[model samples]
Target: MSDILHVATRKGLVSFKRAGNEWRANAPAFIGQPVSAVLADARDGTLYAALRLGHFGVKLHRSDDAGASWSEIAAPAFPTVETPDDNAPAVDMIWTLVAGGADEPGVLWAGTTPGGLFKSSDCGATWSLNDSLWNLPERKDWAGGGYDLPGIHSVLVDPRDAKSLTVGVSTGGVWPSADGGGSWRLTGTGLRAEYMPPDLVFDLKMQDVHRLSACAAAPDIVWCQHHNGMFRSIDGGETYSEITGVKPSVFGFAVAAHPSDPNTAWFVPAIKDELRIPVDAELVVTQTSDGGKTFASQSDGLPAVSYDLVYRHGLAVDRTGSRLAMGSTTGNLWTSDDSGRRWTQIHGHLPPIAEVAFG
Candidate 1:
């Protein structure tokens, strides 16, 4: 069996495989416009990708034989009235796609750009709007600034219990659902809303959590990377506490959890100011072995003090927990097989990468 890596770039969905010590890129699977997100089902090896076109709206594609070929599927239509003025606003775009259920298959979920949750039953053929999250009473007050707006960047499904799930947004904080998408609640406690006064009750623009990962051993444990700092939740998404104490920049876009050890996780830190550059201007990966109580830098083979920017959707760990891979906005793909202690540049020269996943 061959190991495949699916990446979403400005060109389209591309596939890569390991050949000895080098990585080789395959032909473009879906070639039309840029793909926002690409995911492979661990259960069946089915590849699903989200394509965003300038005038064609959002399109979902699926491939059964890996990324060798693909077919387009129709998206769910929002409810409408006979009157022309009652038309629903177009879906901004899909930013993330996640597969659920490891045993009894046939479940998929997606999050959109304007920050809406969606579900699909017949694989990736069609979808339905999850209004339970988008229409929540608290959504009316959500706010954004600069390039940070309300868009779902991460969606985590509990391996222990398929019904429980968590979703993270850019400036909208994190939302959790106990019984799937039937009901939802805001679980942004201990997260500082940057736009509000320190003494205010609930600041709508605070806690811009970009990445969230679940612990494999302890399903309730989760690690999150925010615009301001890093946090860990012991009791699922109910609460979180600061983890990084080195006065690090605390402004990064990606985080990943160890496949076997729930307490071990990784995060990339960048400068936190409006300039949005790397602090100390170096590319490094930090790891916490004792859940988020402490953290240490692990950059034996990474770039030393350069201006490479790792996007929020680029960091991922394989199922075996042996290899760690991440892509940068500067068009370089780096991989570390030694649990992030050392690194290597596997593939570069591709267009700007939006998201990456290992299969």
Candidate 2:
């Protein structure tokens, strides 16, 4: 069987297949404006994508034929609107979508751009606002300017329990729902919140997490790539310990856990500053064979010198744990078939990419 890769691009959704050593790009999956998120449900082989139009609110698209074609679904309305701005009503853009409920194959959970959690009961055909999270008092404090509260960048559903879920807000920190979004609590104990002053205890911004991946073998085990460095949580994010140590430039955007090994994972470390110079940039994918105790640079096949910036939402690893792919804002997609130790530019002719996913 061929491995299919889904890429969310500025132009539209693109699908590619790995045939031998070459990646052949297929026709655009969604037409019109750019796509914000593209995901493939492993439980039912259904494809879900979110489109971001200029002022026309976000739209959800789904493809049952594995990106061969797509159809638009009626977008769900955001529950709370303070005042109707002169502009168009801001629709919550879905950032991440995951298949939920083993008994109900079509049930899907989605995280939104405004950092709200949602659910789709009819297999991505329609969705409803999850008030359990959207109506929280803390939801009003989410910031949305820059690397801040852009949306729910990461959403993790427990593999063992369908009722448990965790989501990461760009600046708001991590929130956990034990009863499937009915009640939520801030799980940012060890995370660094930037709002807190430097001298304060447990500043929120110390670990502005962008991506979260739970170990398949150990559900309580999770890894995070924060704005500062990398972190690992053995107790399902209750607390975390910095694993990157004193690396001069330890800023990264994405993290991927090994499919079968909870202690092994990979991450793409970018240049620390905005200068975009590679002299100080690591430009390497770091790996930890024994969890996050120690990480070694895995740059055998990656660029030796480049200023490509890997965004916070762009790195992903396949279920087989053999392939790793990361999309760059510089409009290039890098793939590694040998567990991130080696990589190659599979596709780079498209517009700047926002996110990438493999199933």
Q: Candidate 1 — which pairs collide?
A: 193-206, 253-312
TM-score of each candidate structure, all chains considered together: 0.92, 0.91
lDDT of 2 at 147: 37
- Candidate 2: segments with Cα more than 4 A from true spot: 80-89, 145-150, 193-196, 199-207, 246-248, 276-282
Tens-place lDDT digits, model 2, residues 1-359: 22888888888887788888788788886655788887788888888888888778788878888776778886656644567665433455766777786666888877776666778889877778787777777766676623334577777888888888888877667787888878888875665543456674364433356788888768788888877567888898878777757243456777888878888988777664466433354467778888777777777766666666777668887877878888877778988888877788887667778788875
Candidate 2 scores a C-alpha RMSD against the true structure in Å of 2.6
Clashing pairs in 2: 192-204, 192-205, 192-206, 192-207, 193-203, 193-204, 193-205, 194-204, 194-205, 263-291
lDDT of 1: 0.76
Q: Which candidate has the highest TM-score of all? A: 1
Model 2 clash number: 10
Number of the top-ranking candidate, with lDDT as the measure: 1
